[model samples]
Target: MAKTFERGISSIPGYKELTENMSIQDLPLPSELIIPLRQHIGAPNRRLVSVGERVKAGQIIGDSDAAISAPVHTGLSGVVREIGSRMTQTGQMEDCVVIEVDPEQEKVKYTADDVSHLTKEEIVQRIKAAGIVGMGGAGFPTHIKITPQTKIEYLVLNGCECEPYLTCDHRLMLEYADEMIAGARILSRVLDNAKVIFGIEVNKQDAIDLLKEKLKNEERMEVVPLDVKYPQGAEKQLIYATTGRSVPPGKLPAEVAVVVQNVATAKAVADAVIYRKPLTERIVTLTGDAAVQPGNYRVFVGTTLAHLINSTGGLKPDVGKIIMGGPMTGWAQKSLEAPIVKACGGVIALTREQLAAAQEYYACVRCGKCVDHCPMALYPNYIGMYAELGKYKQAQEWGALDCFECGICAYVCPSRRPLIEFIRRSKRA
Candidate 1:
């Protein structure tokens, strides 16, 4: 039988349409920014710029010889104030470069050589130099994902921002489809002319229709309408939904000969290759009841959450919880000062009432809804029970790390058990 989420799997309420056509408020460029050395999943970049050293935009400040690592750049032209560990979004201390921006912003020029004219190597080098990592919350480098070592097949563009209350990608799809496809072409060029599969959920029919109408002539790039579901944006699930391939647990999609890139990530690649702009800004969804004006904004990396809130008229005085990214996998944050890193897909401002009541968290009723909705097909109740018991090793054996935390299990459970949270806590323990 095919897997699907529960009926009435509630969406993020008040998911109002955020039009990207309007002029978004520019966040006050911070006097200084905290640029972490290890934004990607790999080893931290080795810092090269010392304290008091001046670096320009697109200037590579940290680099690594490690293949899995992506280089880091100074988002703003600035003088390095310090290089040391600081508290990051994930709430762990990591090494970061603190830079004080020059009062007069340094100008970085883009020669405007079209991507079609650039060689694959030239594009790849430009991507690396631009410090272009995934901006759609994955943080993977564009260069690494663009180069497919295997025979090219389908190019899965993840536009299904399935996470609740977040429509950053949605707004982008509705407004920036042309630029998005231009970016997709760069990836396709690198992939040796693979057919494109732009995946968007049924809920995002506007986005689907928008891209479909635009790509009337591009036969190779077809829009694939997917079942509106949680975790649909996940690479493995997306591949299966779009092409019927099971990416085995503990293996990358590439291991099964597939390359998946988020739509936002694809756009970033286009900017790096065509505009020669470093990955410095991203469109982040700022929504939920607590925000004075809930909308999406294109913000530069390293801008503080408080800065965005203030610019958006500040969070309502009684804002209960601040979440970074989509509600499903987002980190519940207590700090307002956390800077918007590259991987952040959205910033959520939730009022007290919007926050889920603890009273709703009931004991497991043995309903097995968790098991039914889990995309990984693990025994969520069993895994969740073991996790609650503090059996970290057993939880790992039960595939705790594999949980994408899409919340389908919790969404369907009659008991309102926090199955994902249980597994997450166990994995951390």
Candidate 2:
């Protein structure tokens, strides 16, 4: 048995029902899309097209020569209406390309004349061209991750969609199992045929069984069942659960000779390599009681939150907050105008009642629940306390930066303390 990470919530109510019997639905294209230039972590891309310039679907709209960045593409054939700044989901203002969708437009289909003759270098090139990133929300470039400095020995595909109220990955595993498997094969080859393991939570037994059956003949790849817990899909946690390899703090996965990519990203790699397609869209889960129709959607990148809500019969009048990504780590959006980016996995519009009740912070009674529930095994309560006292260096020493903000500390806190928020502030400081 694998030694799983200590301190994780076993379950959260109201999330499991959203994953049952859910199939993907195609979202209607938006009238206009706001494509941000700085979707990835590193330097933002420069605009390649100006206002009034016509662009085809999958056409590169922004790119940079920087090594750490990836290109950004438009997902629809349209005219560039404006080039301006817009607020991204991360609360950063970035240059955005506003494109007005052409009423009668045909999407470009990618088809590689030959796929079997492709080399590893060719595969990397295609992935870079496709603008594939860690679709699980990190937004790191996929090509760069696959090309590591150390000799990679393991390539882990994360299928543990452990976040509450988010089922996009689960649906992808069920719907695009074969494509994902092919992607794993391609990625393994890119890593010089490293051992590939698909790590999924046991709750997704259907996905596990399907992938296992599909990968029986493939010697280098296998699916491993994981414990169903919050933050189980996190790269480090998944790495430890699947491979029993612990990545040292403040180091990349390459330090341990491991390459971790999300299941959706793998499928994207396969699509990019085999069909020469760029990542213009992805599966997004629009769920919660606020959603009139809760289901998975093949949403085009840059589509507005309002367009998605309207397509799904709009939000209930009693909706309280709209979050992008999962409940534990997702960002709360003030408006529905925010456009979907490459890293966005799911949009959760929670009802007022479903939302957690607001609470005033109380002095920590030195109860160790926060520490007890911290997956990183850091003293979250102390970090929060040090941060509140403006002793940021002390908080850093307590491993505030290592906190992935899984929200478990806050979730289990009896004092209703905002430990996660304090830790985030300390990291920023």
Candidate 3:
């Protein structure tokens, strides 16, 4: 039985034109990289490299023994010019290791022809050492997810790049379907051979078809076409859509015998276990009205957002805002200096006029539109109201913390109320 989702927007403005005929391109190495020690959700990694130290590409410059954290590696061979604090896109000031690229330096590649002989525990260890994390924008360490307290039943791969203006995952599915499948197999092994499913949106028929064709010879895996809705790619929503399992509020998917991973994360697992590549780089969609050249980019993790934009033909003169990810759920950047991290899936630049025209906030009009459109079935209006009054406890009672901050409520609010922002504040409070 397929679990049905209640409410979500079917169409997003300015999304269709961006993904059409998109292909992956590599951004040439930048002159410098500011690698942050805190890219994952857990404890920040401890700095292992100091200023003036020469480091090779893929070398771990930061690590932590904390069970929840992931290591940070240098994306390029360079000498550390500075090691200090810098504000990331998420507004946290973190220790950033600044490296000046050594153009003459040669990169060392690590590849293993045979990883099938390795045990499951050894494979997980390799993934942890490589610093692989959820690349679907959450940045949860992949090793921690594979190591579950509950007995796993289902392993769902999120190929639903439902977020608007992001096509990197779509391209990855089309180009790296084999890698993704291989990684899924490794993940399944880690979970004692849990059933695997690929959950993708119907809008990406190409990716779905490609994966299906590739899986002809494969077994124990299937492709699932999800509704073309905002937030369909969200972990909980994907789990429910594919497996008919709803994760309890404040509970994890593991609680429901489900383990979810992004397609890119799966591919990274394959790369780490087979090719010995670290999580030093990722595919990022650089698109929007302000982008002179909009396409998917294979970018190094620590490269500056500005450098990425510039390398890809630079931004338009009328650019107003630069977002670190997709418009709906991505964080707005105050400056382009924010380095690309493991979780970043796209860098979007919108013209100021366009942003201003689209965002005209007004007071909530007591409309039930937000409630109707909320996929989580939480009352956004009441939560926003309670949050505005600083009644966080009341907001909590209304399920504010349960809100995934998908921005759908705000998108549907005719009054243009920033419901997601209010709910976020309440969650933090």
RMSD of each: 2.8, 1.5, 1.7
Candidate 3 lDDT, tens digit per residue, 69-120?
9998987898999999887877668889999998775868676659878998
Tell me the lDDT of candidate 2.
0.87
lDDT of 3 at 86: 89
Candidate 2 C-alpha error for residue 287, in Å: 0.6
Write model 1 residue lDDT over 1-429, tens digit each, in one string.
Answer: 223333324344425454323334456667777788888877788998899998887777788998877877777888899888877777777888888888788567766665567887897888877777877678887788777677768888988777777777887787778778998988888888888999888777778888988898998998988766677777788888787787877887877677898898888777778888778778888887788877778886767787788877887888888889877777878687677888897888777876656336777888876786687787778778888888888888888888777777876777878877898898788
Which 10 consecutive positions of candidate 2 have the poorest summed lDDT? 1-10
Please estimate how well model 1 matches the true structure, expressed as its whole-model Cα lDDT: 0.78
Indicate the worst ten consecutive residues by lDDT in candidate 1. 1-10
Query: CA lDDT, every prediction?
Result: 0.78, 0.87, 0.87
What is candidate 1's CA lDDT for residue 137? 78
Q: Tens-digit lDDT track for model 2 on 186-216?
A: 9998999999999988878899999889989
Residue 23, model 3: Cα distance from true site in angstroms = 1.7
Worst 10 residues of 3 by lDDT: 1-10
As for candidate 1, its clashing pairs are: none
